[model samples]
Target: MASEPESDAFHEAVPLAELEAEGRALVAVEGVPVALFHHEGEIRAVNNRCPHMGFPLTEGSVDEGVLTCHWHHARFELSCGDTFDPWADDVDTYPTEVREGVVHVNPTPRRSDPPAVHWRERLDDGLEQNLRLVLAKSAVALQDVGVDPAETVETGVLFGTRYREGGWSSGLTILVALANRLDDLDDEDRKRALYQGLTEVTSDCADQPPKFDQEEFAARDVPFERLESWFRENVEVRDADGAERTLRTAVAAGATPEQLTGMLVAAATDHRYLDTGHTFDYVNKATEALDLIGWDHEAAADVLASLVRGLASADRAEERSSWRQPVDLAAMCDETFDRLDDLVAEGEGKEWKRPDGFTDRLHAADPEEVFDALEGAIEDGATVEQLARAVAYAAGRRVALFATNNEFSDWNTVHHTFTFANAVHRAAQRTETTELYRGVFDAAVNVYLDRFLNTPPAPEPSPDPDADPDEELEGLLTCFETQGRVNRAGAHAAHYLDGGGDPERLKAELGSALVREDTGFHTFQAYEAACRQFDLREDAAERRDLLVAAARYLSAHYPTRREREGTFSIAARLLDGERVHGADAGSDAEVATGDD
Candidate 1:
């Protein structure tokens, strides 16, 4: 707000004799719209515009001490402009005094405290009422006051556990998982992660009161094997209490993160890509994030505990043909891992070359051809870096190839695969790349699992490759932000080629877009992997092929429900509050309802 001027501090409006009792008047004092009300033997003034909407408050009905905006029926106290409805923010009140018969109003309202304090209050109101806008403001403003982002995370976690029914969910899982990764990220990314964590939890718990779950851990000294059995049984039965107790018991008994991870993965894999692979991915990522932040088993106990419900909620894959069919995919994955080991050994003395066709073979997607290419690349002396890149791209392809026409909850199918592959790719950075091959093999299994989804694969690039590179690149980016459809991306590629845009430039553009549109941890990992591959400045054609794979993968899996009018609207509104963006429409789905 601008400072009050020395001159014309108070502007006189209508006289008291001319004003009618129990009436509202709209008057402009020093160019500020003020709603003056003659009610209950005194005069009160507030901003003319309703806080809920831009509707004029002068047109609203006033009774006793309350003023109601007719537009949304949001009520505010007459003098203070404090709203009764949480969604509707408080309207600014102006100081007013009547000297004799003349009405005077101060255009510049008095400020009693800093914005941080006010925003904090608004945040509390938001949390209490589940107002997303206020939630966003408070989260952002809290940091401005030197408040730690972790506090926000803790706040969100408490809110989620205390309010949401059915206990933990993917939403809460996302929150807890991101909380573990906060320290490893840059300042900006940390803020985003924190904001995402808080918003996800609030969104998850919104509209639902907490359902208390009884805690029941085994009291007897149980063997590790017995406890694992008991834990799996409890998880299978959706017994959150028993599972939590079993997990805590293991942690307390000096269980390694690896052991806990093994147990979770066992429960997860027992379901054959549980929840379209999200359960295992969440389990894996949460565990990995703990490792990245140097958090021990004690810290990770809660992380896994939060996921018990999500794991229990999943429909197990043991009954599917993917597991029980003539060709056992799970066993095949084991064999592939074995082959990967032998191939890594075989490539020891061989000179390395970039496997340009690796992604192509994965896309061409004859299971045998792709498998052979994986082994052949190793024989041709593919470096750990090259192999890791190819495997991660292949993982992304699994996500892209997923059918989008399924039920809303099924969208996690693609999301889990992509994010899981991303998690593996990132984890490979710190650990030896050889171990991450299991991730490659797992991604391959998912590719095989989802083969039925992509009845028709992604279309190849245009034969006549001649187009304006700049314009085509722009079109492609526009399509990513707007439509995010496969056909549109293909068309843009064709136009770019038709206009003489080379594969190299197109890849660079795609990489830049991936970096810009990085939605979360997995997206960031994909972009980072691309940067590392390209930072070497080798393999132009290989880079182009990889970019094409990315384009195809993105095409297959874009315009996602994740970016729909739901949660994005809250984010958008927050940005709008900063005057940096515009408002968006609300979503039919609740916040954190199947939101990744």
Candidate 2:
């Protein structure tokens, strides 16, 4: 047989009318394979390259008005080549027309260029060169066609090739030419067109260059100030790439702190860019810009506060788990706090004077209270540990008040109480206080007694359960175990208990010790625990009288009221449980369980 003719390799076009109802034809046009489909009474042709990963559309199947790429099973609208997957770039669309019962492709080759190179591309000569050429051709075409400025910008953006393999200089040159065109029009229209074009270009330039030289670029009659002002006034209200460009432009132009602050506030409030990571950088830059401008102390403080609040809000809403592991909230907070603290410290001691009662209002509004009031708002969300940390930070300043009397002595007491209070608060909120507190208390008591008081000699074998405490207590509890000596041990035991103790016999030992030394707080805590464990309500009034007497005896010695209050508070809670007077009523149930 004669060799087949090379011409036979070319695919013959199917007559438009001859297309089977459910058939597709793969044809070669201009040496490129094209897929043809006849469905829903129309002839559709698409380039064989799949929009996603360039899979061949020819090997794909058409069913129910959609084409599925065989390689990746990506579906597209046969008529428009619009990929159904939003993440997939759209496919090339070719105009198909039927003539004389034959489907004809325009053969001129319809090509879709890449997205436009955003204005930031102007910073790179090679890239800018390609971008300029693309823009130049687009502008000339758009002008010849009499397109509106907005439409012109949009059309060029959609059809322009963003970054050519070599560079984007062509697109930048086109943009510069477009910018020059602005000078020929009347002032108002020219400014408007420039603003519109800048907006469009910047909006498309999501990944901006790290830096730009504003003065040099502005010398080219770009009306950089006018464009920036327009952006600040209008575009900055949204966090689109366009808005980012405007802000960056303003920064480049040396915008004032107030101006930058205003832009940031607008961007933050818009909620459009809130989810985008761009806002963080903007806030940080704006903060630095404010410092450079020598903003009024109050204004700077306010701006810093706003940034912190915005960051906090974002942190809460963000899916931190999906974010990079070990998110460092403390590091971020520390940095922010340092900045604000420095500003405050250097402000000539000029306190941030707000309207009367403003500080008071903020101080009075505890987040815990807000959380309680809006309990339903949380749904089942875990406790906001950051919020708790913020509260602790605010409360830290007040801790000094408890240390005024006897610095070291008071500090130790207050510090210990502070830790206990925080633990109790956390436990109560979690509704695990009873068990957690008891466990912690028991473990602490055991550790302290074993390690501090009852520690065995080194290398001795472990003692049997049947070992007698009489041997350990022999000398310590001899006749010298008078009321005073016994009272001393009782006081020590009370110290351990208040720190988180659970020894049952510690109270009797403490009482006897206190009878000798008369350590008032020790007697108080010991008697309190004893009353609770042994149901000493019958002697409750008598014990209270005795505690008063002991308080009087120690009045001339150790720091009295301050130390007594914590001990007494803990004692009251232990003794009366829910019936305790003046102890945190809300904590009564937890205290009743004797956990903490």
RMSD of each: 9.0, 31.2
Show model 2 residue runs off by greater than 4 Å: 1-22, 97-103, 108-255, 258-282, 286-596
Weakest 10 consecutive residues of candidate 2 by summed lDDT: 452-461
Minimal lDDT window, size 10, model 1: 587-596
**lDDT, model 1:** 0.60
Q: Candidate 2's residue-wise lDDT over 394-447, tens digit each?
A: 222222122122323332232222222222223223332112222122112111
lDDT of 1 by residue, 1-596 (tens): 44544445777877877666437677776546688898888788887766554456777888989999887799999878888888888887877777777888887765465766676677667776766556655665676677776666656655565566655555555665655545445544455555555566667777786655444354646677787788889888887778878887877776665566657655654445566555655665556545543446234566557667778888655457766576666666566665777888888888876554556676554566666776677777776456656666665554444444544344345445655555444444444535456555565556555565555644545545546678777878777766546556756765675666765566555544432332444443333333334343354444443444456445544444443223334443433331121152322111112222
Cα deviation of 486, candidate 1, in Å: 2.6
- lDDT of each model, Cα atoms only? 0.60, 0.35
